[model samples]
Target: MADMSLGPGLGSSDTCRSAARQAGAPRVLLVIPCFNEEASIGGLLNEIAAIGRGYHTLVVDDGSSDATCTVASCRSPVARLAQNLGIGGAVQTGIKYAARQDFDFCIQIDGDGQHDPRAIEKLLDAYRSHPTNITIGSRFIDHSGFCSTPMRRAGIRLIVLALNGLFTGGRITDPTSGMRLLDRSAIAFFARSYPADFPEPISLAWAMRAGLTVSEVPVEMRARKAGVSSIDGIKSASYMIRVLGYILLARLVRAP
Candidate 1:
């Protein structure tokens, strides 16, 4: 089982109430999945604390062989996985925790610091105004942020074409965006089963197939603050091909 523990000054009834008053928002949990991100985790936690939005933060350490858990524990609660389960497993762990804890919403944020914490408000607002099962933070809609390399952009375009063609849901511009918001229903569905590989694109396809509504809000993303990306260099090409394959396969299978 994954070990769950709260960080100092977090996950308390008093804390939750205080945050609710500050934001006047429902129970929201920020699920951060990290692997060997010790260099950047501390900064990310500090940034969230600075926001002071009352959204509870959970760092799902995906069996990092570093001090990531140690650093994250100093700020927010952590559900440390016993072993590396890739991004999919790590996110599913967080989703399950959110379901059991009865959170109103769960937001997935990467630990490498590419996703901006300030844009979180944009996501929350989108959900509040036009609620959907999933709200994706996209850098392509406005095209104002660091939109990544040309090759990766091309790859994302291909994946988007495939998703729009295969799925009946609305058009998805950035299927590879890591930042997303999930309602209770989406959380429950993903908690039960989330893709373990090429999760971003594949899970989006699965969620759509499962009859969940998805929408996107424009958010600016910066380059990674620290640590090398898992999908870099030649790996980008391989990632694109594999993710495309998974998206097609997901279309063929029954929705989870």
Candidate 2:
């Protein structure tokens, strides 16, 4: 999508010539943020590699207390966070890396395997077709039979409704969905000021506030292959309130 070769050739410089020659690859980085997701990280990395896009996958361990780092290290090009930073921190670290490396784009997928590597093409397609927009994967857009528990679905709906209100005209079906693709401009914005917690919705609001193009494409999501959700039960309710509050705060802070 969008000239898969969106940035400089893999090795316009001699340093990366070998990497470039090994694969006539595009300069894309798949940033998977992990929190104790050892069981699924291996499978996710292998699947992403199979996409055959010369796109490198980097796992930010997020201070996972389990075998996450070991599993990730077994794979090349993975970055580990020495301490457990929350999701936002881990993702911000990835964005900074992507920006510094001059990557054309960065795709954020879950380390839990709920996000499908196959959808990488769709994200790339969306980004290519709408070069200026940030493409978010929306599970509810056409709901190709993927199942979400009723309670979880309800919470997602509530968040989307609130997000639309705050943003005035934006319609987002999955405000908390972790799967997203960001072009260079979007990446630069996130690298500098990503929200510390409950970032997806807040980031969307921030993007719209800055008059950036933001869009969503429908993608099927799989159930988590392993590990409990980082936000659920009491934590889910707490996070919902926290995320909603952040959305309001973002709107207020941006208002004239």
lDDT of 2: 0.78
- Residues 1-256, candidate 1: write the lDDT tens digits: 4554545544457565566658856888899999999999999999998998877899999999999999998888887778888899899888987887778899999999999999998999999899999999999999997999998999999999999999976678989999999998999999889988888999989999988989999999999988887777789999999988888888887855
Model 2 / residue 249 / CA error / Å: 0.8
Number of the top lDDT candidate: 1
> Candidate 2 lDDT, tens digit per residue, 97-125?
78877777899999999998899889888
Error of 1 at 27 (Å): 0.5
What residue pairs are clashing in model 2?
2-128
In candidate 2, how many Å is residue 17 off?
A: 8.3
Per-prediction backbone clash count: 0, 1
Q: Estimate each model's TM-score.
A: 0.92, 0.87
Instruction: Give the clash total for candidate 2.
Output: 1
